[model samples]
Target chain A: MADSIEKVSIVISKGSLEGVYPGLIMGNGARMEGIEANLFFTFFGLDVIRKNRIDKIKVGTVGNPGMHMPTWIGAIPGMSWLATKMMSRQMDKIDIPPVREFIEMIGDSGGKLYACQATVDMYGLSMDDFVPQVEKVLTVGEFYELSAGGEIIFT
Target chain B: MTTVTLAGTPVEVDDEGFLQKPEQWTREMGEEMARSAGIEKLTERHWQVIDFMRKTYLDTGAAPSMRALGKTSGVAIKELYELFPKGPAKLAAKIGGIPKPRGCV
Candidate 1:
């Protein structure tokens, strides 16, 4: 309680729609609080900011016990689409935006978005593959340095 | 239920201090809740935000979250805290006599 939260830096490793939304929502929520917000996307998490995939991310029903069904049932064809549709419908009732629109909202509201250079290299993806919201690609060391003095959350 | 007299009339509140009924909410009750939340005075800006929250909740049947409040109420989040103290969204919802907004904790 001695130190007030001046900033929040979130790192995302998973790429599913459920995994990606927490970072986006929390980062956007912090920005709403007038705090500095930063999101670092790595590995599969890069899909969240990818130009081609950001709008197309889906729920990973496999092994997700929250689906309330067996793993094999979740793995059935069209189940992921069904899950995604259900999630989108549920979120709509709360006025929550879709992924693409949510990303745009954050960028327009001054939330910082970054991509991991190592992951970009590993996936052989260039800046063009990322959404225009990505400010830059930062190395792990640079992220660590910039994220200093802020609360770091791994999602 | 907890009862607190507002404008000389007793009103019931839930365990979390939110009003038990939306129809029981009034400007005086909001001011009382603001006072309890550590705001000594309800300024023009505070009323603006509170009125917007109340209107939105009435129309939508849901309390406005922080994001919705900030975007539509012409009030900044930091200023909301300054007006409502400890927790702005829940405090505003409580004052507005709306249910607590889920997914915003």
Candidate 2:
């Protein structure tokens, strides 16, 4: 039965810039293990599946509990921007790959990325707004159908 | 249990673990992990980012964000996008072998 678990599916519901990495990592990791992996990008998660906006996704710092209050307070009106910068800098100092790169890597590695049809309609986004590699825009039920019989991880 | 030292701290390793010492995370090890992740080769730029990530982990005990990573590593945001098309948060964490960071889910 363990060997029969040949595929893995993940659902990414969070849309925040900071919230997108987990799905990316897990999906990519599964693919590295030679497992068939699918990622269902819904709601805010659609931002990554969106072509133009995917690269522009920004970190959320306002009211974020993890933000350093003193540094955030010092930035004042530009705290969000500053926090984003600081976070990126810290990541660079450590050698972690950035979000956009991870997505490309995953796609290049043969992992499938999909957008939610309902969210596209609700957010007024169109097919042109998404990257070329996205397989399709699907509904929750459709995504569930794709994810059935495999591990469905909602990140 | 076997113990290995990391930055002067002793970390216990399971009996069958591959990393019996902190230094076991060698360039070869990193290269293999990168290859497994579908990165065929490691350029100086890749090593630069990876070394920085490791150092940052030693210093702060957490994964840094892309913006912060850029500032400290002198890698421009745009270039970062070029280097890590998937977004720095995920790729960096993956290469660093760290658990997914908070808020990334």
Candidate 3:
């Protein structure tokens, strides 16, 4: 009876595990609902699709209030690793896939994955640096063009 | 919630047309629901996925996620989409007379 969302374009800008998963989950959910979904990874978010770094993303224990710990403790060495490990275990229990598998699942479900061309250029990275699921790299203008009639979500 | 007649029997369904009482489902009702979802015919592959979904829901009290379905449904993800276009997990769950999946992934 009411209008339904037909398309969604999500921008992933932060490199932390927390920052990337939200966008991935949203994009995957959109595709599950039969909506056209696009994931545009930019700036630090490029790490998500980076072949070398994607699997190494860690939780930002330091400077993150969600950690619910004293900042000094969070800044301690090995704290982020412990946090990441714990978080990953929790996610695994709930059947959430790891980052690489999640991206592949999204791709398999027909959601588009894109890297920001400007970031790729600035970082001296090439398409080879990205996972194969990344369809292409697009500039800001191209991203806007592709997102023309859809909701743009920045995470 | 609403009640709709499928294959001549009335069943309770949610707003998205997923069955609220999945136990009320029958193969005929599944066929009827499939027709409404745009699958004019339910091939053997469709029944495989639907059977998997229904069995999983009954066993676990929840439908399997798309990833789980792909991993264990004996149907590849790409072909699952081909069998039930658009949203394979969502559409299959609906036509299989199960509640809509609650997970984001």
The prediction achieving the highest lDDT against the true structure is 3
Candidate number of the best DockQ:
3
lDDT of 3 by residue, B18-101 (tens): 889888989999888888888999999999999999899999988888889989999988788788766888988988889998
For model 3, the stretches where C-alpha displacement exceeds 4 angstroms are none
Give one digit per residue, the lDDT tens place, for model 1 in A74-146. Answer: 9999999999999988986776778887887677657789999999999998989999999999999999898
Q: After superposition, how far is residue A93 of candidate 1 from its true place, in Å?
A: 1.5
Output candidate 3 Cα RMSD: 1.2
DockQ of 3: 0.72
lDDT of 1 by residue, B1-105 (tens): 889887677888776677878898888878887787677888898888877877888887777766577677998655665676445667677767766656542
Better of 1 and 2 by TM-score: 1
RMSD of each: 5.5, 9.3, 1.2
User: What's the lDDT of the predicted structure labeled candidate 2?
Assistant: 0.66
User: How well does each candidate superpose onto the true structure, as a TM-score?
Assistant: 0.68, 0.57, 0.96
